[model samples]
Target: MGKLLTVFTPTYNRAYCLERCYQSLLRQSNRNFIWMIIDDGSTDDTKQLVEKWIEEDLIEIKYVWQKNQGMHGAHNTAYKLIKTELNVCIDSDDYMSDDAVEKITDFWMRNGSNNVSGLIGLDADLNDNIIGTKMPENLKKSTLFNLYNKYGVTGDKKLIYRTELTRSFPYPLFDNEKYVGLAYKYYLLDTKFEMLLMNEVICYVEYLPDGSSKNMYKQYVNNPKGFAFYRKELMKLPFVGKKFKFKQAIHYVSSSFIQKNRAFIVESPERYLTVLAIPFGLILYLYITSLVLHK
Candidate 1:
């Protein structure tokens, strides 16, 4: 038997968009993967809809529910239960192209994984518009800093990774339920493994009006403590180079300065003060982000 691929979807209160994802999986040209849904405490009819799919037997589905812990928590649960050689995450509101699995599997088969840890692919919206097409060239195996700063790899486009290399995001880092900076965790695997960039578009991300990034400003305003936690974690990444280290430090200090709550700053006064001395923090942030394009 060939190695199984587990496609994990972490969802919360997104019943309306969930079907698009399920339907896409049902139409996949390849059926060697299992669709694992980790429901993060949705009080809506999400469970009913998922159960209906299970009854129809449209695809190999596993529905797991847990108390509301946030996206990372749901991912942690899914990662633990997925018994597949390779794993991928399709957001609840997103779906995959019909040929996505075939393309990914074929790439793995041909490449033979001498040093590849996972695969990355183009992410598009429901309209099939490219999301990060203009990202820096030769971004394959770029550091987390390079990904977010130089290239816009913050979005959900990457594909299945080796189960052994995946790690759970540290729970203490998140103050509320928001999921930011989680992508930084992927850098942990970058040192030993490089990702294969499959020029093909595989995932379709639905831009939900209420998505996490939509309320980013509010998230930062209301949860400065959590934002502070995220900054500290980013600074500690072993794979990040000096530029990202400085950028992360600047981000933390800037956020503290903008929020003006002095609590986290008071707690880490030395670190916070050091960031202000960097001299061109805002300019650097803008320059790095402006490089993203859809080419």
Candidate 2:
């Protein structure tokens, strides 16, 4: 039978740091997963590095090179190509724990089903510190959204998803834009299925200065359409509270100003909320713009 899980990494010009992730995969106690690398138009030696690794034949690897699209676009291609029943993204700058694959497969086999999306696990730093607080041990299943807003779970956690669900809400691509919030798809999946939670640390992460997480202001300035698209969808979610929707509206307004979309209020799902958010949004827009300019 084929591997039960696919660990995919979407990368662009990260050849220098990609080896850390690759080496970590090689150390996996369980080799029952496939490693798929989606090369998002990297101008570096990424292809050459991956080619060498393929020759080593340490574990199953699938590498696909495509023209530069942002991280979301690379995810689009990865989901399309993945044939495994389950998938998780291990960022180019991050590495998995040696037993992560073993833990994930065993957990899923014991508890996974179509009724639940997949599972959420912990992420640690290089020193083995958990990025966020642990999941509520007594909790059985919860959507990603609830885990944060409702339960007050903090920090970044690892997510494993059913490949089919990951493919369901594809991030929209816009001209000259490279980023769309990855959570756009996750929130949509929440609408359909709640995820199982496991407190085990599965991945180690390092936030590089140039990483998207570190340069969100630049992302906002450069990818307003993508941001706008994400905010609009978040505002439409039914499970979240009005306060959450209002927060989304504020972001939507800010993104609209960046995109210079005059019809933002007319197009918003919550027009009244957007109207109330205009001043805050404008302030946020100026703040983001100032950061980008000074950066």
lDDT of 2 by residue, 130-195 (tens): 987888989989999999998989999999999988989888889999999999999989999899
Give Cα-based local distance difference scores for all models: 0.71, 0.95
Return the top candidate by lDDT. Answer: 2
Off by over 4 Å in 1: 112-114, 134-156, 168-177, 238-243, 254-295
lDDT of 1 at 33: 85
Candidate 1 on 177-229: residue-level lDDT in tens? 45545564576566666676667788888777777776565555555556666
Backbone clashes under 3 angstroms, per model: 4, 0
TM-score of 1: 0.81
lDDT of 2 at 29: 93
Q: Return the TM-score for candidate 2, rounded to 2 decimals.
A: 0.99
